[model samples]
Target: MSLENTRHPAGPGLDELVPSRYALRVGDIDVLVVSDGILSLPTKMLAHDADPAVRAAWLKDMFLPPEMVDWALNVVVVRSGDRTILVDAGWGADPNLPRAGRLAQRLEAAGIDLGSVTDVVLTHMHMDHIGGLLVDGIKDRLRPDLRIHVAAAEVEFWASPDFSRTSMPPGFPDALRTAAKRFLNEYRSQLRLFEEKCEVAPGVVATRTGGHTPGHSVVRLASGGDRLTFAGDAVFTVGFEHPDWHNGFEHFPEESARVRVRLLRELAETGELLVATHMPFPSVGHVAVAGDVFRWIPAIWDY
Candidate 1:
C-alpha cells in the first residue's frame, strides 16, 4: 500500500497508516520513536554473498517476502530536560521511490514541531536517513537554524568531490554530487562535524562505530541508571539473527560486520534498550545473549 492508502489505527500487526510510535521515560529524558513509514527494496540488498538457501531460510524465519525486503524508516526523538533532539531524519518524497515522505505528519502526531528540533544526530549520510533533513513542504533550503550533527569522516566521505568521482557506484555519481552540494549549501552553519566521540548534549553522546558509512556513529542516551542506544543502520533487517551478515547497503561490509558484532555483544551483555531504525514497528527492544548468538525480544508494553 502507498503511504496515503494505509491507515494504522491503534491496533496490532502494524497497519499501514500512522505506524505506532512508543516512548519511555528515564529520569526526565523521554525517548520517542517516530514513524516515518516503510519502504521495500530488493531482497538481495540484505546479503550480497549469502547462499541462496541461507537467504531463503532467513526470509522464512522472518516471515518476509522472498522477493522484496521491507525496511522501516524510523526517526528517534529525544527530549532531555530542555532540549528536543531529533536523531537521523527520515525519507523525503521521491517520485521514483513511493513509500516515503510520511515523517512530517507522524512528527505532528507525536506532538513534535520541526522548528522545535534543536539538534539532528546523524548515524550516516545515506539518502533514506538524511533525506528528511531538507524541508519538504517548502521549496528552497533546509532548516537553517537546526544544529545538524554528523561524524567528520561521514561528512568528508559523502561531501568529497573525489568520493563522488571515485567511490560512488556507476550511474550514481551525478546524484551523489547533487546531494553533496545540497547538504553543503543548505546546512552549512547547522552542520556540526565531530570526530570519534563527542557529547551531543547532556544525556546523549556520539559513540564511534564506523563501517556502515566511513564515520557512522550511534547515539547513546543515559539518565540515572537507564540507558538506550539509538543504533541507526548499523544492522538493518534481522540484525540479531544474523549480526554477522553484512548489509549490502553498507559502504564497508566487513567493517560493518565487525562493528555490528561488537555492538550487539555489548548491548546483549549490558542489557540496554536497543532502538534500531529498521526492526518491527515501534522498534524498541532488548538483545538477549544465548551462548555466542543474540536474540531479539520485542517490547511487551502494558498498553
Candidate 2:
C-alpha cells in the first residue's frame, strides 16, 4: 500500500489543560515537580538499529501507540533550608511548542516566585533542559542573586571547536550549537562549573553520568536520610524495560546505554526516589528490579 493510502491508528489527542504541578516533602526539604509541557517524537526515533517490526510489537504489547513516543518535560524545584534551587530550566518561550514554556506559569501556580530562585542546577546543556533559563534570548534575571551550576565537562564539551563541527542530523547541530553558545555567553558571569560528585546545593550533588551528552549529569538530593535522584535523561520510562535501547538524541549511544543500565540497577537496588525528566507528568518514581531488567514504580500520589 502507498504510504499515503496506509491508515495507521492514532493515539489520544494531546491534553494540555491538566494541572502540571505536584509537591512532596523529603525530610526538611520541599521538592516540587513542575511541568513545562510535553514533548512528542516519532517512535522510529528510538532504537534505530532494532527491527521495525520488533519495535512496533514492543509498543503494541505495552498498549501504547506504535507510531509516537510522548515524554513529559518535567523540572524539579527543591527548597532546602533557606535556599531555593531549580534543577534544569524548561524550554522558555518557544513558538514552535505552544504547550511547553509553561515553567514560569507552573512555578507561580506552585507558589514559587521566580525571583526567589537562588540556585539553578543543570543536568546537561540540552536545549530542553536549559532553554527555560532564557526567554527570547533574555536571561530571567528575576533572581538577581541567581547562581547557575552546571557540569564543567558539559560546558567544556559544548564550548569545544570539535563539538561545533560535529556532524548531526539535518537542522539540529546549528540550532544546538547556537543555543549552547548563547547559554554560555548569557550565563558566563553566573555560571559555576563543577566536577563529578560536586554539591550544587546544601544537600544536592551533581553526579557525573555523561553519555547522552559529553557531560550529562544527574542531581541527587539527600535529606534526613531520605534520598531522591533526579536522573536528567539517563533513562526514560520505556528505557526501564529496555535499558540497552538508545535514543537517537544521545551523543554516544553505547556509553549512554552503559550508564543507564548501571544507574537503573543502583536505583533499583537502593529503592531511592527516581525522578525522570521524560516520564509521565510529575515524573517521580522508584526503580525496582524485575527479573533481570528494571521496572518503574511511580511514587504514590498524595493528592
Report RMSD for candidate 2. Answer: 9.0
- In terms of TM-score, how similar is model 2 to the real structure? 0.89
Give the range where candidate 2 is weakest over 10 consecutive residues by summed lDDT: 1-10
Q: 150-241, model 2: which lDDT tens digit per residue?
A: 88889998875243312344666677777789889988888888888777667888888988887799988888888899999898866887
| lDDT by residue (tens digit), candidate 1, 54-156 | 9988898879889887788888888776677888877777776667756766666555567777778888777667777655553233345667788888878
TM-score of each: 0.87, 0.89
Best by TM-score: 2
* Top-scoring candidate (lDDT): 2
Cα TM-score of candidate 1: 0.87
**lDDT of candidate 1 at residue 280, scale 0 to 100:** 63
Backbone clashes for every candidate come to 3, 0
lDDT accuracy of residue 290 in candidate 2: 72
